[model samples]
Target: MVNTRTTDYWSQFIVDYSGGGDFFIANAYGKSAAQLSYDRVLFGSALQVVENIKLINNIIVVDLPVSAFQGLSLSPDDRAFYQVIADNQHLTGYEDLSSAFRPKKRIRRVDGPYEAEYFDGVYSAEKVRFIKLSRKLIEGELQVGVVVYLAQTLQSRNEMAHDISVKALQLVSVIFTIALSVCYVFIWFIVRPIRRLNTVLSERAPTDLTPIDTDAPKEISELLRTINHFMMQLQNTLDRLKHFTSETAHQVRTPLAGILAQSQNALMENDKPKRHSQITQVIDSCESLSRTVDQLLNQALLAHRFKSKALEKVWLGALIKEVSRDQVLTALQQKVELAYIGPNDDCQIVGDTVALKKMLQNIIENAIKYSPKQGVVEITLIIEKNREINDIRPRYGHS
Candidate 1:
């Protein structure tokens, strides 16, 4: 009985040891399975976080595992693959699962505080801006891992800016066109009166010195008045010249005829005394002709001097005496006694000397010519209370 009991106890102890060994092995296997399940759950959570970020922000996210870098998690998009480079500057893994995007140079590992970089390049034959981000994970052994974020191209933004510029240019062109049109109209109205004035002047004859008759603005009207005044002065000058020409011709013809007739009469006379008388008459006629020519020349000279010379201080009494002395010969030939009766004191006046002398000479010559034989022609200078007056009178002798 004792041997049987010992056998039973030993069998029982062996069975317990086997069962405990099996339990220890099964517990270790279950703990390993639970840890694997936890890792999968955590990895799934990380992928979900990455997907949520991509959905909210509209960007691509790539999460790479350092231990098994080939088993990386990527947000769902049209992009085909992504290249993962290690901090050692070596390409570690790539997502070759999809055939959507063509192979291109993607994100590079960055070492500084900034995690992103921007570059410009051609993508699918269109200009685009490429934005890349590389982030180092700092939790656990995953610190060796990197997270990449990418943004879409900036083609749309550039197109929007171009549209705005085109609209601004169009608006400026419209404003410039309006300003040009307004200026053209304003200038046309301003020059209308000038064009009419030019036309009127062009159509008139060269000899026509008549005043212009046209409606115009105040400024143009003032100009027209000035032009009319000039025309009137020109017309007066032309009329005076015409009259002077006719008078000169008549005066010259009369003296020449008288000289010719007297010369012929002197030649035909038979008696010596009568011939001598005729010759004397011819000499007188010649002298009269010379005097007439000289008077004409002096008149012309006086007219010119009156326009050109300024007034001067003249001694009126002295000028009168000098003119009287010059005409003494003519007075004797005409059988007239010329006398100057006035105050001996000389009188002063503001006048042109040539003009005053000519006036006095004309008065004395007229008085002497019209006087009867042996008549007295007196040039009297009279001083009144307010002014000086010169009196030329002819006194005839009774028969």
Candidate 2:
């Protein structure tokens, strides 16, 4: 489209120049027939072209010898106009002239307006464009071809286009900068609090399970709350561990000291019976100490499992039977009869199996221990419908 428009202006200019030649003939209307005939050929067949604010002072015929247009060719000192036609033969036809001129040769679309030089003429090249125009004419009985070239320099249009482009680029750059700044501000607000939390956490000692204090957004505040909850749990666990360690040391020390004393007593005794009794006491003390250690270990394991939320379905009848069997020998030694009674159907309940078994065992054993000689330690599983017991106490009765 740009090429077409460029060629159009040049073509219009050529037509205008030809009209000027016709006016010249009109002024010499009263001349002789031979002169009028010559003027008609000159005005009708002559190619009128303009370039760089100057008229085309030279002309040439393509197929004919250079001498044919001798007077017309010698009119211009600058042969550049003729040189353009000789280089592009397609510019000879009126129809092909618009399409033949390539933008690369004569037209340049620049980023900004600047000065342009053409045909020894310097003009503001801002929006200036060049085009080639051509047409066919009749000279007597022969068909002659005429070509014209022209330049259209537009300073106002170039300045407008350049100004619009600059403003558009500036607007895009401003928006991009604002978007980047907002993202940076958002990231800083989010990351700053997290970094503070990390610092507080990293500076704590291994044993320091204290809750943390954080001044942060709601989301970060929730995260801190979870951390504090876990820290409280850890503190509780640590306290339990300390208490268990001290109790174990105290409980273990007594039986161990008694065992040592029994050993020394056994060594001093000369009589076989006396020595045997001392050895028996030492064995009993050792067994009791072992039982205490086992109970303490099992308690620790139960606490750990509960902390992990480990639970399972347990049958009350089966659990009671198992505990009674384990305590049967102990009950026999204490001269007590251990018995278990349960419903025909198994009573199922959800709880930690290890903890439940230990609880039943401790209760039955205590009952047997406190019972009189020849007393019965009868265990019963009583199922109460729609009742949840908040507290329970074990009682023993001698029969």
The candidate that achieves the highest lDDT relative to the unseen native structure: 1
lDDT of 2 at 127: 29
- Over 1-399, each residue of candidate 2 has an lDDT whose tens digit, in order, gives 379666556544533353443433432331233232332222222223312112232334344234323433332331221222433454442443333334544322121122221221222322223333444444455454444443333333233343343344445457768999999999998989999999999999998888897697886898989999999998998999999999999999999999999999899899999999999999999999999999999889888989986578877778778888999899899988877755556677889888888888778878988898988877766667774322224445676
Q: TM-score of predicted model 1? A: 0.43
* lDDT (Cα) of model 2: 0.59
Least accurate stretch of 10 residues (summed lDDT) in model 2? 111-120
Cα error, candidate 1, residue 190 (Å): 4.2
TM-score of each model, in listed order? 0.43, 0.53
Q: Model 2 off-target regions past 4 Å?
A: 1-178, 328-336, 372-374, 388-399
Which runs of model 1 end up more than 4 angstroms from their true locations? Answer: 1-192, 261-277, 298-315, 321-348, 364-380, 388-399
